[model samples]
Target: MRRPRPKRGERRIDAATDHLAQYGFAKPQIRNVIHDLLQLYGRDGWVFLEEGSYPMVLNRLLEEQAQQDQDEDGSTITDE
Candidate 1:
């Protein structure tokens, strides 16, 4: 017997996982992130992923993380 086909949501998850993995996210974390994004954006998240804007989302997430890390490290200077 062959495996059953995945539904649209499942396919979306799979695609998102693959794309996110390229950005160094682990499978488990990717799933959780996607779930959270879905909850946060609602239907708009699905449209964003379908339109290939998820990569942009991931990039922004990474940039934020880097900024946070930099701030924590006190490498970011504040001008008086």
Candidate 2:
């Protein structure tokens, strides 16, 4: 069966999926990551119900959360 076309509001998510596919993500992986992102930041008004434009917004939210966590712990996760 063919996949259903994305609705109008899902264009950004669709675009993000296409972008991730170029980087070697399979459909399932993309869907999983997007779901995780949505679960984490879906209620912050970053995601538009009328347009799929949350990837960049979610990235910023993740960065901010990481920084806040580091600040609260008084330490940072250094790459070794």
TM-score leader: 1
lDDT of 1 by residue, 1-80 (tens): 99899886568788877777887877676777677778888966788755754865586567667887998998976799
CA lDDT of each candidate? 0.73, 0.59
Deviation in Å, model 1, residue 68 alpha carbon: 5.9
| RMSD per model, one decimal | 5.2, 8.9
- Overlapping backbone residue pairs in candidate 2 total 0
lDDT digits (tens) for residues 1-80 of candidate 2: 99998796476667766655664546566656566656876745334522454455345445655787899999967899
Deviating ranges (above 4 Å) for candidate 2: 1-10, 43-80
User: Model 1 scores what on Cα lDDT?
Assistant: 0.73
